[model samples]
Target: MHPRAGQTKKRTRIQAKNEAKILEAALDIFATFGFRGTTIDQIAQKAEMSKPNLLYYFRRKEDIYISVLERTLDEWLTPLTELDPDGDPIEEIGKYTSLKLKMSQNDPTASRLFANEILHGAPMIEHVLKGSLKNLVDEKAAVIHHWVKAGKLTKVDPYHLIFMIWATTQHYADFKIQMRAILGDDVDQPDYYEKAGQTISTVFFEGIKPR
Candidate 1:
């Protein structure tokens, strides 16, 4: 028999400072260097722990990276899942804008880590992309289809819409040095996310909202 979803999926907890510190260090380390390039020793040093102690929680560098991704992906896709199929399209879009911007601003490390994974062709996470990520995309595409059919939003390729969202939101994180040099250091200021959110939201909602 197939295992139940709840049974198969376990959650993470940051019950203590050390665990949180470890994860924070792991996130920064993985983001700075791609998975193949990061080392357990580096992570341990960053977290102020010995390699053996870090290994107590995460067996390998891959495990730590996956943990960070799991936590980040869960938070990242939340805005989509929060969209109320029955609610106003404009409102949902606004909420998504803020949520996505917050991820870009507050969790740039997580974003870079994910970007690094995909840039290298996602050898470790292709399975996840094919499975859970693909499933969620298909499900949301169905909702977006209804909006288009009902004349609530513009008719656009749903897959490409998703891709646009990911690409636009992740650009600052993935291309930090270039973006900073071009836009100035304040590109990451708090207002930066607000401005980005508002700009993207306006551009999208204006184009899509039943005109």
Candidate 2:
């Protein structure tokens, strides 16, 4: 029988550790080679597990890849879900931008993985995107739309605004090499996220604020 996650039996703790190790290795391999380019053998080798042993946990490579992606997508979009409708829109957007830029710098591999998914039309996350994602955006856009209608903010395309935020924040991840080249190696420093996040928050909040 499958053991409870936290209630690991003698064999289960080791099993859980192995699964985490495998997932970590898989992240690095899949981030570098992408889901289509990676192989079960390569992942097994990276995780230092036998092919059959890895298979004991994950039935297929797709299962592992999808599981990794599910986690990544969940994290990638979490900031948006935290936005409060009653909060000041500027602060809300600023905070979201900061959170996203921080993620871009902190977990670049995960970002690239998600990017690859979207680049391929998000086949794995298409349902989530069309469902939970659309619902959140639709709700948030209405909030922004209401602000504009109430003269609290300048009129802007709510969907486009969201798209812009996503594209801008994710640029640091999706185009890290180019960003590093253009922004220089300081972009990789420990405080880089703080400085970058502040700048993004400034640019977006200032540009979007009403007169």
Candidate 3:
């Protein structure tokens, strides 16, 4: 049987630190190479540890991949989970869009990692997407629909709107190379992201304003 997580009794601080190092290294390798392209050897090298030592914490590459995906999904969805229904709908959504844009700028690797998984049909995380992600989106969509009914937002499909926000925000990270090449050094300017967030929020909320 596969070893259960935390099966080992009372891990020490050094073990915890080493485990974190291994997982962080795994994220970089997996994001760069994708799961099929990455290997335990590469992860071990990235972590600056021997393969045998790395295997002590995670016996297989699959375990490390799953752990990274779980953590990434938790972080990626935090802004969405924090959206407040009690706030002004436009402001709430604008803040969410801004937060996503900031994440795209600050954590492009994580964004691309998630995108890569989705591009490959999410073999490693389809269950989480279909279950936890879907449930969360459904709950938020209800809130959006309520806003629409109350004349706060225009009558638009909330799910599609959510998808649009995700795609637009994530584009900055997944396509940063293309963006940088096209825009030159201007892409590196902080104002570029601020303008992007402002533009995206303006266009979206304005387009969906009650008519």
Candidate 4:
């Protein structure tokens, strides 16, 4: 179902605001309940709006779910999109790693939601995964390869390196419960993210620096 705003009419400020609210509420609901288990009413309640009013923006639960996923993907990929080909390879990669880890630390629900979608085969976003996501990763992978060819980094499979960075950074979010359990209260310390970022950067840089 197309969102009501997509009907060739420019959305008013109020309409836009309501749509944002609905999506934010829907994200929380879908993340907790899974897509199949979430309902339009649940989203409406979360958004603190009437069901009919919420329906004015999103026609179905699936539409809202897809919108939430798309928004998450856009935010999730913004750091990668900013990767500068002309920048120093180690610094650029380190910055990207820190940004990703910060996202995981600050918004673990978004990470777990995305991870769950992928684990279920990404039925709702398979095309996006195959098309835009694959294309973006390919573009960044080339940047990594260029750095290596310029003797800026050690030899490594660019694709696998990208995958490795994603896995290592997102683990903090996707397995927060397990991590907190094992690490005790240290994970809750004020400087935990700072330390994690420094440790990740050090490990990645040490392994990839030309040897």
> All candidates' lDDT scores?
0.78, 0.82, 0.89, 0.87
Worst 10 residues of 3 by lDDT: 1-10
Instruction: Give me candidate 1's TM-score against the actual structure.
Output: 0.83
Q: Give lDDT tens digits, candidate 4, residues 1-211.
A: 3346467877788888899999888888887778887888888998999999898787777888888998898898899999999999988988899889989888887988888888888899999989999999999999999999999999999999999999999998888778789988888775887888877887887754666
Encode model 1's per-residue lDDT on 92-199: one tens digit a residue.
756775677677777788788888888899988899889988888898878877887899877887778777877887886687788789889788577876777777
TM-score of 4: 0.88
Better of 1 and 3 by lDDT: 3
TM-score, ranked from best to worst: 3, 4, 2, 1
> Model 4 off-target regions past 4 Å?
1-6, 207-211
Top of the candidates by TM-score:
3
lDDT per residue (tens digit) for residues 8-115 in model 2: 455667777988888888887888788899999999999999998898778789888987877677777788988878888777877788788878888889888878
Estimate, for each residue in 123-166, the C-alpha lDDT of model 3 and write its tens digit: 99999988989999999999999999999988899999899999
Please give the lDDT score for candidate 3.
0.89
Selected candidate, larger lDDT, 1 vs 2: 2
Off by over 4 Å in 3: 1-8, 207-211
TM-score of each: 0.83, 0.86, 0.92, 0.88
Structure candidate 1, residue pairs in collision: none
Instruction: Give the count of colliding residue pairs in each prediction.
Output: 0, 0, 0, 0
Candidate closest to the true structure, highest lDDT: 3
Task: Estimate the overall C-alpha local distance difference test score of candidate 4.
Answer: 0.87
